[model samples]
Target: MRPGLFASPRPDNLGLHDGLLAPAPSTPNGVSSQATDSKHFVAPLPMPTDCCVSAMEKLHGIIESLGHAEIISADDGYLHAEFHTPLLGFVDDVEIVCNEQEGVCHVRSVSRMGHSDLGKNRQRVEDIRKRLEGWGYCC
Candidate 1:
């Protein structure tokens, strides 16, 4: 349970549907079974997973040319990058998602500074992706 939202993690005996609330079943132990449907509460979100070191190198150069540093963060199934660009003497953060196997990446600006600058930087991003493809990294 999130802080300041509930007294405890106990399931609420009320079910919500179409904005209407209804009572939920109580378990044999007197615990509310509302948590039984908690599994449905978390819906999977779309994620990009196609990325490769070659593509990462391509993106690194693109951001580097913009006076930024590319930081790669990877796990077993995900490869994410955070681009730290110097803006107004401070670092601006940008996020990148990629599928390591497909060598494809979806880049986005997660910070305000990067978002505002994205419109004018589209060509640069495209250039990097194209370069990566020319080198045989493809999705």
Candidate 2:
């Protein structure tokens, strides 16, 4: 499994061609329809446990500093974070998606209500990214 390449979920049904703009098995019309959806996608596996843990620690620190953010859920594969954002004047639930194939993480701050309003939740994401870079997680 590469970063974004996926195998056909059902090769027998031409399902793979249905999702491809240039159909693998071209039609008589000689013009393939643009496919916009895929039935399946394979993601790269995570790095070694030690490497993953090290990166996670770096991410943890960034979230903690943001607002004592508590890790709602975390595993070697992914991490879900929740914390108060002074900038937004509210608590936000952020999802940090990681790809072990390359040991890379993508953090997206999702809106969550918790005794405050949404302000600069995006900024918190930036801070987290910078810290990850500092911690050597490929940013």
- Which model scores highest in lDDT? 2
Instruction: Assess each prediction's global lDDT (C-alpha) against the native.
Output: 0.36, 0.44
Leading candidate by TM-score: 2
**Model 1 worst lDDT run, 10 consecutive residues:** 24-33
Which TM-score value belongs to model 2? 0.50
Model 1 agreement with the true structure over 34-115: per-residue lDDT tens digits: 1245421111112235445545555555555654444444433323333333433323233344444443454432232222
Q: Clashes in model 1: which pairs?
A: 49-98, 49-99, 50-98, 50-99, 50-104, 51-99, 51-100
Q: Given candidate 2, what's the lDDT at residue 101?
A: 52
If candidate 1 were superposed on the true structure by all CA atoms, what would the RMSD be? Answer: 16.2
lDDT tens readout by residue for model 2, 1-139: 1111221121222212232212312211111112122311112222343466666766777777765476766775456665543343344455554445554454444333222223344456556656656666532
What are the RMSDs of all candidates, in order?
Answer: 16.2, 15.4
Which segments of candidate 1 are over 4 A away from where they belong? Answer: 1-67, 77-87, 100-103
At residue 82, candidate 2 shows an lDDT of 53
Global fold similarity of model 1 (TM-score):
0.38
Clashes of each: 7, 4
